[model samples]
Target: MGFDQYHEPPNELPDEVRTFARMILSLIEEAQAIDWYEQRMAVEKDKEAKAIMRNAQKEEFKHFGMDLEFLLRRKPQWREILQGILFQDGDIVEHGEEAEEAVD
Candidate 1:
């Protein structure tokens, strides 16, 4: 299997860390799939083809959400940081800074 996700030696990492890395890669791949479908939908002239692409994109969104939730459950600090940034109406950068500060 591909171990391209790891910068460090996979053998040296704990099982949980390895799983985290795999999930992170899966999340990235899902996001890429979503983007690809979106681009294809934009250029696609056929209405039925665009509808299929949209359906596929929706699946990717579900996959991305599940992956994110799994990662958040694994890392409480990450959850805390995202809680400060996500679903908020204010400045995102400001929220990020605040989240970091809140963690400290």
Candidate 2:
């Protein structure tokens, strides 16, 4: 829902970890925008809207992929830690736990 819902308790993570989580959340926000644009393009037959959605979707994918790769390559441990924190209680947790174990 809101940013606060995504955040873990402050005591659970260091400043750096918190910052990285925020960065990932920002990427998610951008991704959501891309999705919104795509949906709008699908519903509307406007030429300009379609073009804008296409460009935005491509850019969003590029940015999202780059950010994910950066997290996986640069700070892998932190990435794993962040995943655990983000997904611990969600429906994704079971699948995520498998992925987390593989990373470990």
Q: What's the lDDT for all of these models?
A: 0.95, 0.73
lDDT per residue as tens, model 2, 53-80: 7888888888887777666676778677
Q: Name model 2 segments beyond 4 Å from true.
A: 1-12, 74-104
* Per-prediction TM-score to the true structure, in the order listed: 0.94, 0.59
Prediction 2 TM-score vs. true = 0.59
Q: Which portions of model 1 miss their true places by more than 4 Å?
A: none
Pairs clashing within candidate 2: none
Q: What pairs collide in candidate 1? A: none
